[model samples]
Target: MVSSSQPLASLIGRKILDQGGNAADAAVAVAAALAVTEPCSTGIGGDAFCLFYDAKSKTVKALNASGRCPEALTIEKLRSLGFEGDSVPNTSAHSVTVPGAAAGWVDTVDLFGSKRLSLAQILEPATELAERGFPVSELTAQFWKRGEQRIMNASPNGHEMLRHGKAAPAAGEIMKLPNMGKTFRALAEQGKAGFYEGRIAESIVKTLGDLGSTMTLDDLKNHSSTPVEPISIVYNDQLRVHECPPNGQGITALIALGILDSLQSKGKRAFLDAGVNSVSYLHTVIEALRLAFADSKFFVTDPEKVHVPVNELLSKEYLAKRAELIDPQNTKAVAHGSPANSSDTVYFSVVDKEGNACSFINSNYEGFGSAIVPEGCGFVLQNRGSNFNLDPNHPNALAPLKRPYHTIIPAMVTRMDGSLHISYGVMGGFMQPQGHVQVLLNMHHFGMTPQEALDTPRICIMPEEEGRSVVLVEEGIRPGVVEGLKALGHEIQVVTGLMRANFGRGQIIVRREDEESAGGHVLVAGCDPRCDGIAVAQF
Candidate 1:
């Protein structure tokens, strides 16, 4: 089974599976396809992270393929450019980093794919779609138009991504990106060296250099993916959830889960008050997430630079201490409990018949990224560096060769016996981790199916200064719940129409241990209807 935010992308993954590819191969296919069909959110000029569960080894491995700041990019330079202290403009060339998606795709396929399938085979579907156009989906067209009107038009040569050499293609309008297909063909013939070392790499360097950037070809060539141990926490002793370490925000979901479990174990009945949509459950989880984000803001960064006390933060002693701050009756902002821890784009899950699963996420960050599509290169560069702070004293402050705080993450859940249960992720700017915690609890604790968990209304707490919070709630949420949350002191914005898509587009695959049939374990999956996504199986 394969799922993604674009139907053709998901179909491409299912196609790879039908061709006998493993989950890893299917992942590469789907990610590549999304870059073609959903260019507003993802592309070759981006970054990726994935969680791969090797069922044979009964272990999950994490890959961090996020790119780093340009070797010449520095806080002093950004400060001089008037981007003082977390004020980096999203449109600035400095906001663009060395893209890692191409390299990440190669690394994942090399590490986990079968010998039967090569990178060319994996990327075939995407290349075909890019060569011959595909119709734009509604949500994608909306974002595409937003970029064309707001950012791309002002950017030098950014309009190249627009259809007909003009505005963004409207929904259902067929658009072709032949240059991207050429780039993919190059990758097919030359592998990682194609993207990081040759024409594509040269285009990336010249694109940035011509636009007042300090980037060099060495910065692009130096980028490589890593095989890292996935950090995990046993949640409620019923299942274990895993996330990538710092530099990505996966740890926030784990922290929120730890806090929720600690609260319930202490006889806090608010969680059990009602179903997934209940006010009590919503408020409690939101507050717990508040605490999680506080610590995440204080400590989450690229651990390669500063020491991040991950073990100390995930310790039961520290979590229980953090849970003590939540008040069941009255809701208020929670403080960091002295424990430190831990989008746009496509978030998809692929599970093969062999039981291996890959939870993957790819993004250009902040809606069309830097909006700097190089001439004839056929993709946009990521504004991921805008996530960095300009404060020289800050851990996530801009620096040469440093990765900024990232928002894209892939998540997986395993049963107590170490069997994979769920491979999932949600894609949006900051709504990702909040979406993760809510969807997880809905399935495990509230007994919702994969579809129900994703379909449920979501609420995100927009962090303001101390003692204040702004919560964005989907319009489908009950009116009484809105009043109740407002009464609890949250300033609410009820989002509707296209605006509510900000909650995130998610995909989930649940490998039911109890479900067995002629096909073996039943792979239940669902995709967010909020976007043009789907879930499919070859069985």
Candidate 2:
């Protein structure tokens, strides 16, 4: 089963599966297509993380294709320039992180795929669509209109590609990206080397330099994708949680789960009480995130440069100690020490008939990704650079060839029997971990279907600096629960007509205890209702 936010994209995955590809193959194909069709959320310029579960081995492997800072970038240099702020300078040059999506695709395919498609073959649809153009989706058009100034100021090439020398393209306008076509062509012929070391790299370096950015060819050439072991925690007798490692706050999700596990083990299942547990769990997790993110801010640099105790963070003793901070009845207003820049990202999942699975999350930071289209590359550069702190003393401070604190995280859950249980993810900067915990609770605690869990009203506790903590609720949340939450001191914000799609865009695939496979697309899947994304099965 393949699930995506777009039905057409889902159909593409189903088509690949029908053609005899496994979950990983189909997911890669659909993701490639989505890069072209859903450029507002993700593209070749972004970074990706994935967890692939292999049925034959009953083991899961993680791929971290997160981008890296340029070799010339350093905390001292950034501080010396006096560009201190929570936000990164929004320009093509400053926005560009070493892109890892293409490399991720290559690595995933090389490691697990059977009938390998050349980069050209896999990306041919995107290239053709880029050249011939496709209608701008309503979502993309909205973001373009709202962010036109930044798009224009990001880079000359960006202005040319996004606006065709005019203002930002309107909704339904035929948008073409000939440069992306050229980049795809080179990748198809030369593989990753084409993008990292050849003309594509040269174009990126020159464009960034021209825009006063510090990226160099060496930074491009030295980028690599690492396979890391996922962090796991036990939730109950049957369920186990897994997430990407540091630089990403996926551990926040684990922390939340651990807290919930403690509550459930005590036989506390009151629905409203469970809601209280949910909030409390989030509170503790946020505190842990505060500490972990403090480390992320100051110490979680590239694994090559810093020593990260991956095991210690996920240890039971640490989690138990963290969970002890939860107050079952009170809502605490936590402080947001620093804000990570938000990104427009996408998440999708695939589960094959044989039960192999892949949960993938990819992002380009903000919408249109710093809007810096490299001349002749056909894609916007990612503003993941904004994730770095400008402060010289910060752990996540800009450093030569270092990985920034990341937000995109792919999630997986397995049964004790070693079978794939679920593949899922939520997009949004800080909200990702919060969303993941909510969905997991809805499923594991409430026994909801994947769709029911994802479609349910969601709440995100914004960084406390926003002062009043606002919980944006979807249309269907229990009114009494809202009242109860309000009574508990949450500043209630009733969002009419979907306040945030990120709260609901999660996609999931589940393997039931009986060995049946099921899949779900969130309510936002109907953003383009006319498209076809029905989940299918083959016996």
Question: Best by lDDT, which number?
Answer: 1
- As for model 2, its CA RMSD to the true structure in angstroms is 3.9
Clash count (model 1, backbone only)? 1
Report the C-alpha lDDT of model 2 over 324-372, residue by residue, as the tens digit.
Answer: 5545465564433432434377788888766678888877877777777
> Please, what is the whole-model Cα lDDT of each candidate in the order they appear?
0.85, 0.69
Model 2, residue pairs in steric clash: 120-188, 179-378, 180-378, 297-395, 297-396, 298-395, 343-365
- In the range 328-432, model 1's lDDT, one tens digit per residue, is 667776563221111367799999989999999999887788888776778888988887878788777788998888889899999989999999998886788
Per-model TM against the reference:
0.96, 0.88
Going through the candidates in the order shown, the clash numbers are 1, 7
Over the full model, what C-alpha lDDT does candidate 2 score relative to the true structure?
0.69
lDDT of residue 317 for candidate 2: 74
